[model samples]
Target: MKIPERYQPKNNKSFASYWQPTKDNLLPFLLPKTNISDSEKLVPYYFKVDDLADEVAVEYFTNTPFNQAIAKLHTDFSLFPSNKNRLSLATQNLFQQLNEVPSWVDFDLVNLGTSYCNRTGTAALSVLRNYCLMGGYESSAINKPLIFTQALHKGAVKRLADTVDFWMYVTEINGLKPNNKGIYAVLTTRLIHAYSRIQIEKKSEWKSELWGRPINLWDMLATNLGFSIAFIDGLSKLKFKPTAKELEAVLHLWKYVGYLMGIPLHLLPNTGEEAAKQLFLWSKSQKGIDTDSKQLAWALYDEPLRVTFTKNKIMKWFVQKTNLGYNEVLLGTESRQELALPYSKAKYWILFLNKINEYFDTKAKSNPDYYNKIAKQGRKAQEKVWKLYQQAK
Candidate 1:
């Protein structure tokens, strides 16, 4: 499909400002029924997996001994040419693909993005947990058997930890390098998705669906927007306003992340307004929330509370109250009703008071110390949650 002219980024200050979303700008965040015809048209560009399945590529990735060798070479670049001739043709091809970073990457912007994330601290985690994860589940395409079984049904705390790890790795500079842990983690995930598509398509259940593939280009783009656009929106609703540059840097950071995750570049938005347009398009393309979506949403909402609020009644009460307010305000009333979550006046007031505290805290002290304290607390909490998950199993 040809890119819309208005969605294209313009080279002017007016065109570059942070998008202010109005009521009219807000799209109905419902999943749409899949259109087979539309899916077919996008398959070649968006869901191409031939490269991943190439005989040589598959052998290199699948062979345990060869994978060990590649890991050694990856950790110590000095070991590359030593096994250069011993390496299979497939291994060579895979190596090149792994090293290929997008030409558009701006290191300065990447650093700025890191700083922006640092400034946001634990608040970013709240946005990610409450908004992005919940919003992702709202997509029926994403809530299908493959993902639902592999992720949502597999303990929420584990799922949340895995997601947090991804965000942390992607934003860190060391994680962006070729053959690094972050790149490997993302590529491994992409391969898993491709494998899931192949396996799921053969099933009677998936074949009956309008879209043939389990994860398509539209779904990938929507998921990307959840991390970028939806995350920023969540932060804004929480009263944590980022500077224009910080916003752009964060989007740019995720743009590179999308590129690494195998999303087609053309589908990614260059500006917040363009992102909003793309999100609206995605929402219009989906059927409304399904049973799977509701199941996943409820799990996502309740599991974190269950794990985090094991003790400290007052703290647990505050967190749950604030979370309810965050969901109601950010997810919209329709989504709240759809998820069967009730509005709590106490929660709304709790959120208001917390926002006031956040503002005053910022005004009273430099944020580095505050950010450090929050990060420390978050780390401890995540570790405890991880331990609990392990214990339950």
Candidate 2:
């Protein structure tokens, strides 16, 4: 698909030349017309057709007997034996949609990306936990249903499981392939989001202007960008810089993942730089923060800490302190003020620790044993987070 003229980068400049790492670039994009109605609405210009396609898929899954079996499996995996026929039928019906792996995907690049994620370790977790969570809350489209249902607080374990499954897919071998655990998890999430959209749209209180359809294409793109572009930016702020090649591999990994998750090809950028620009454009198009944004942001910020650290005050304090610093730096002043996060001396300490870790990481990259050790540490941390999710449940 040809890129839209408006969406194309200005002057046809390469993203590296077009993007500047400065305060101006970090600031949110401003829409040209401030007073226009629906300024806050994130209409999927590039992917409207794809959105329609997804809607059809959702309708089929929701109305079919296959969905019943899927739900049963969710409740008890042991029931899979009884539902084998239904599961087979459902898998066959969804095969073409779920089986596709983009022709452009490079397994080597995916492995490179996975390695980079492993190397970054806890720094990546900080970004996923704080920065991405903050972005989700900032979006009125995402925040409303979450806030209205109190899902972040009440369904914390299920929510965390979904997140863990996502990371495992991106980081695991052959994760994006059809019938793999990662791909299956991704498909299930797509169905769940589609189901949520259908259920939420039926409510009288669900405002189309603010909420859009649940999991609209635009919102999905924004969420994907958070994990890719915004995530890398967050890591950079923490002084953990990936090589340009490593960064590109990370983008490549997520681009394919986005494709599997039903985001259109036109909307998925080939490079991290373009992804950043896309995020900025999407952010500028949205309306200012609302009550729902604030409520949801605060709840997400507090709930995970409360749930995970309940037994150890010292551990909770340390995580909270580091998290606060990371969120402040990544979210920037505007988001911090909007979310009402307080300024802290801990930010200075956080940066210092990041620089110290970066030095060690740089040295460790040359030593295979050290590299393997950190990778194991990173995996262990992920397992701990998964355990926390289970405990929270």
Best by TM-score: 2
Worst 10 residues of 2 by lDDT: 9-18
TM-scores for all predictions: 0.73, 0.78
Could you tell me how far off, in angstroms, the CA of residue 390 lies in candidate 2 after the best superposition? 2.9
Give a tens-digit lDDT track for model 1, residues 243-296. 667678878877877876667688787776667666655554355566767777
Top of the candidates by lDDT: 2
Error of 1 at 166 (Å): 0.8
Candidate 2 regions off by >4 Å? 1-93, 152-158, 308-310, 364-373
Cα RMSD of all models vs. native, in order, equals 7.6, 6.6
Candidate 1 Cα lDDT to native: 0.59
Error of 2 at 118 (Å): 1.3
Each candidate structure's count of clashing pairs: 7, 0
| Superposition-based RMSD of candidate 2 using all C-alpha atoms, in angstroms | 6.6
